[model samples]
Structure formats: structure tokens, C-alpha cells
Target: MSAPLAAVPALTAPKAPKKLRSETVALDSGLTVVAVRKPGVPLVEARLRVPFLSAKAAHPARANLLAEALPTGAGGYDRAGLAAAVQALGGDISVSVDADRLAVSGNVLATNLRALLDLVAALLVEPAYARPEVATERARLVERLGMARARPGVVASEALARRMWGAHPYSLDLPDGDAVAAVTQAQLHATHRDLVRPAGATLVLVGDLPTARLVEQAGAALADWTGSPAARRVPALPASPGGPLLVLDRPGSVQTSVRYGAPAVPRSDPGFPALQLANLIFGGYFSSRWTENIREDKGYTYGPHSRVDHHTLGSTLALDVEVATEVTAPALLETHYELGRIATLPVTEAEVESVRQYAIGTLALSTATQAGLASTLSALAAFDLGLDWIAGQPKRLLATTVDEVSAAAARFFAPTAFTSVVVGDAATIAAPLAALGPVER
Candidate 1:
């Protein structure tokens, strides 16, 4: 009834990354600027990273509000006027904050690169956290945080963060809504003054301009944006003391959200390439073993994924999945089984080859565009890594062997290494899940 399947073609090894034309410069005000010349489109992309980590109890709420309002008004322009100015110069800019850093990112026509940098300098030197704008953004932030906290996935993630990091700033990924409501415009102004500065910050520029010229434009425009931020580096992430699973009761929930977290190596680590491939083969890709077992064979969840997330302070291997509430226990059992299997067993040569190609290919694809390269460079700058590190990744992946990947898997992917959280109807799933291991209610 059906024709025989055609033989799949063998995959070709990815070509080596071409050498990049780039330069790094330290400006007078203690800012680090990385400029790369990537020609294709007539656009330039810019990213600025300011170290924004803080352990103070009220810092998260203040930082969130500051990110929201920083670009809304700056220099002499109101929100609308600033938008108009950027549009006139064929550019756009936005600001975002996280536990590690405050980042400003945007793109502009290559011809307007200097103009966009000037606008960025305006935001840095003279952000107008005006009363009206702060009030508006604050109200909106509270509403968004409320909605996010209400979602099962967000709840599970927040719970996992707390369980893994304890009282660390990393535990406070989302600020409390009441804290946000209490923030004042003066507080946001103070936050900007205290944290948003040039020292220990990096600006990445990628576009059609010559690398040297891009650095010159950035330096010239940002000369007035001076001063070092206070010493606010986030402390080292605490080791995840993997213990009992946290089970939070969400009445009448039809689906269970399962989240797991464990500490992992940074990209600069020697074992990172091996761990990266092992992670992908385990659950990080569509055709991964966990996906095949849980989603394809058992139909427990639509998709189960694992990834290694890099932050300025540390890296974490995270697992996330959602399954029917009734199947929560079985889904978790299957997850644990997959983790144990990968950790204890030797990965096949074929498996290593497949994920190696995949890892190298994805790295190439992620940095192929002007905007993508700019963002990648900005993220890497946190660890003082640069284009050379990126260009050498393929060689690392290719050289990684089955034994090395298996070793990384055994070290990092042990089921007992993870601290997990499950959010669903506790009455229905608790006893079954406890049958597997200890669960804290």
C-alpha cells in the first residue's frame, strides 16, 4: 500500500566559520565597545549591556520600572517625541532588565548609525523618568506581573527559581506586584543614577560600516555618558541542593507543569561543548530521546524540552514540560528514566555525530545576521568571550567524542542533580508522585 522510504542523505560537515573583521576598544569613560563589519543589508545593530545585578530587597521592582521608562522619554523628548526622532532616523530602540544586566538594543539604517548612537547617549546621560511616564509604566508593569504570576508555567518557574536559589537575587525573577505598586518616580531616578553607567558595561555594534568607524562613532556620541556603576555584581549562584520535589496545589488545573533546574557549566568551560551536545541529544531538540519517549511513544506531553541557559553569574540546565494532570506521575517517571539512561549509558557514535553537527549548525545560524551577531556578541561579552571564541566552537564540537558527551551527561544530567517543581491539582497527583519520591507540599 505504501512505497518504501527513501534513504536519508548523509549530512555534510559544516564549513569553518569565516574570519570576522572586528575591533574592541576601551573608551575614555571606561566603556568597552566591540564593533564588527558585517555587510549585506544597509542596517546597523547596537546592543548595550550594563551590569544591573543587586541583592537589595527592593531592587527588582525598581529595576523593572526603570527599564520600562528609560526609553519612553530621554534628553528633552517626551515618549512620543523620542519615538518620532528615532523613526525619522530609520531606527528603533528598547530597554530590558533581568537578574544579571540591563540591556538596551536596537537597529538603524547604516547611514543613520551616528544619529542612533547619539539617541542612545541621550538615554544614558539624561533619561527622563518623568512623573507621568513612570506612573503609566508602573501601572502597566503591575498588571503584566499579575497576569504572569497567574499562569501555571510562570508559577512553576518562579517556584523552581526559589527552590533552587533560596534567598539569592536569582530567585526573584519577577518582582512582587505590591512592591512594583509602591515604587515612586524618585526611586526610579535614583536607580538609574546608581546603576546605569559606562564602566563594566559593553556596547556591541554590527553593520555595514567599517569596524574602526563604528567604534569612532560610538565613542564620539557616548563621550558625555561617563561614570562607573556601583559595585553591584550578583553573587555567585548557590549550588542547587537537589532535594524533594515541590508540589504546589492549583485547584482544577487540567495540565501539570513540570520544571527542573540544575547548575551547569558556562560556555567558556572546557566541558561545555560536550555538555551542549549531550543536552541536545537528551532533550534539547525535537528528535531527542526524551521527546521521542514521552511525546511520540507515550503521548504524555506535547513537547518536553531541556536547555542550558547562560547567565552572567552562572549557567543552568533546565527542563520544562506540560502533561495532562492525570499523567503527571508517569510523565515524571519517564523523565527520570530518560535522564538516568543517558547518564549511565555510553552514547553511540552515530548519536554524537548527529548532535555535533546540530550544535555546530545552530551556532552558525544564530550568528549569521547583523542583528543576531550583535546580540550574540553582547551576551558573550559578559564572560569576556568574543569572536574568536565563537569561531572556534565548531572545532570543539567536532572534536568532542562519544565518551566525552557521555561523561558530561553522567555528570550533569543525573536525575538526582535536579531540583524540580510541579504545579497542578495536588489532590489527584500527590499520592502517585510521592510513590516515586519525596514531594513537599
Candidate 2:
């Protein structure tokens, strides 16, 4: 039998959500804490970000090594012992490292938040970079580095960073092989002491719990944690470290990987929302013009993407695409065409609304889960922002006009502003690329 039709309700624009109430506290030990009370769920999610600035350090890969070895054991617990303990608590924790920080994140029953937190304290305070463990991790890192060197994407990305940052530590993503081999247990220990300090670091927690309870427990658990301040100084970037095409020559390669980007505004900028929407309308999503032009029409690549990546010091708008070597030049030309069009032409209100809704929907979905909200809050804290900053995103994006999107596009998305690199068979694509513009060997 056919179901009876229900009352049809007319659609309307979504109203502003109730403000999210969150607390930010600077602990006496200098660790920052951002806590939001989400009461529906019974799980607690937490993240710890300790900035890793290895520019002046002896071994830039030491943090990377620590990320692997930390999980083996700490504070009188072996690998098996630690795993058993976490399992007993009905919780799990993991560690990872990036250009900026080492992230220690985990989830647990809301009632067991304090227990998991204590384990975290132990791991960070007395991380066991034991010799045997370090050697095993070093072997793994070496193997991974060798594999990354062979991958065209990694090769091109590393080359671009080296050209942009010069001798800055940031330029080196995978540590030099010799440097990785040279990292000693003592060095790892010292690096942790100097860089893993609570000062300027953040600890974010989100879940169903009283704000006061979570704050008090966190303060007590991390009370004894202390160390030297993390080094965080913005490096002096070149006036223009982009433009010339650097090719990562891979002989006999069947495809070329294209990377395009330049330094751009940070998230806190007033024009950020509009710029973000502009990126979306251009290539940040599947429905973007860049994707439609290159993937749907021209059949140049499987997917093309662009994003604004942020760090402690600066931000960048990066675009990436991979196409067959035969079509590399044509693909590059079309990409430029799309960039020029976006920068020069005004976007329609319909396009603006589509991107705005997508942006808002994404933000809402990101904070819909306890773990998601925790990580989101943690990333925001790195920029000295809180929930309020994210709470108003829908409004900011909604208020943005098509003209504003066009202005942002012109200012930041101009094709000429980009410095690009292509990784593929230079012998095949070099001539075509040179015809388009200057090509550096």
C-alpha cells in the first residue's frame, strides 16, 4: 500500500545556531586548555599539540622518531603493558607528527577521562626513547624515506618546499637520510626536553562532562608538567619565492604531477571567509570550476584540488593535479585559463550561495562528533582562536557577496601570483612548458 503523504513544510534559510559555550584557560604551567561541554555523548575526546620547531635543532627528524617510539612504552610501561592498560580503561591513544607539532590524541569513556589523561601525562613526561625502540623506529623511518623519494608527489613537494624555504628547517619534510641515521637516543631525549614543553602548547578536550570537572582534572593531571618554551618565530620569507617552474625530472615517467601555490592570508584575516569560498568555487570541492574544466571536460586528471594550509607562522594556498605526460602542457594551460577567469570575472550569486552552503555544511559536520570537535578546537587554539571564531563562520560566509568573492579571487587567486613545479619526464614536457614561460633547470 502507498504511504499517505505527510504535511509539506516550506523550506527556509537556516537560522543562526545558539552560541557554543566554551572555556579557555591558561594553566599555571603555561599549557593552554580549551574545553567545550557537549553533553549528549558519553565519550571524551582530547588532543595535545606540542609545537616542534627543529630549525635550530641538530636533527630535524628526531620528533618524527619520537612519534613512532613514544607508543612503545613510557613511565614504567612496555608496549604490551601500555596497550593493555589503555584497553582496560576502554580507551585508545595515538601519536603523529607534522611540520608544526606532535599530536597526541585519544578517546575514552567520559568517566575515564582522568585515567586516560594520567596515562598521557606519563607518556609525555617520561617518553621512553629507549635505544632498541629507537633503532627499530629509525629503520622504519629509513625505509619510508626511501619509498617517499621514489614517489613523484613527495619528490615534487619536497623540491618546492626546499626552493621556497631555502635552508630553513621547514623546507625539509622527510629528514635527510644521514640526518635520520645520526639521531641518537640522547638527542631525542634532549629534543623532547626543549621542544615538548607545555608553554605555548595546547590541550583540548571535548565531550559530555561538566566544564569545571574537566578543567580541575586536567589542571591536576598536568600540574607537574613543565619544560622550556617551544621555539616559535616566523621566518623571513622571500619577497617572492614563487614563479619559475622547477621540474623534478623522473625519466620515462608516464605522468606529471603539478603543484601550484603561493603564500596567502591566514584564517584570522577578515577576508578569509570570502577567500575560502572563492577557493571552493574555484577548486576546493568536486563541483568547482577547476574540477569541471579539467576533469569533466578536458579529461586531464582524476581529481584536482586546492586548499589553504596554515602553520604557526604563515599560510599558503596550494593546488595540485596529476596528468598524463602527453597532456601535461595542455592541462597546465587550462588551469591557468581557469585561474585567470576566476580572478578577472565576477562570480554569480548562485555560485557564491552554493559554495557558502557547502562551507557551512562542512563546518557543521566537522563539529558534529566529540572527536571531531576536539580536533577542530585544538587546531583553532593553535591560531589563538576559540569556538566563537568557528561559530560565526556560517554568518560570515552568508554575509559575503559575490563581489566580495570576486575581489578575494583577484587579490589571492591571480594566476600570475602562483609559483609552480611540475614533476614528470622533463624530456617530454620541457619544451612545451618553456614555450609557455621560463623554465628553470
Cα RMSD for candidate 2? Answer: 2.8
- Worst lDDT run of 10 residues, candidate 1, spans 228-237
| Tens digits of per-residue lDDT for model 2, 320-419 | 9889999999999999899999999999988998888889989988988888889988888888876888787888888998999999999988877887
Taking every candidate in turn, the Cα RMSD to the unseen true structure, in Å, is 1.4, 2.8
Q: After superposition, which runs of candidate 1 have C-alpha atoms over 4 Å from their true positions?
A: 1-6
The best candidate in terms of TM-score: 1
Error of 1 at 233 (Å): 6.4
Model 1 per-residue lDDT tens digits across residues 1-441: 999999999988687777779999998888999999999999999999999889999999999989998988888999999999999998999999998899999999999999999999999999999999999999999999999999999999999999999999999889999999999999988888888899989999999999999999999999999887877645678889899999999999999999999999999999999999999999999999999999999999999999999987789999999999999999999999999999999999988898888888888999999999999999999999999999998999888888999999999999999999999999999999999999999
TM for every model, in the order presented, reads: 0.98, 0.95
Query: What range of 10 consecutive residues in model 2 has the weakest lDDT sum?
Result: 231-240
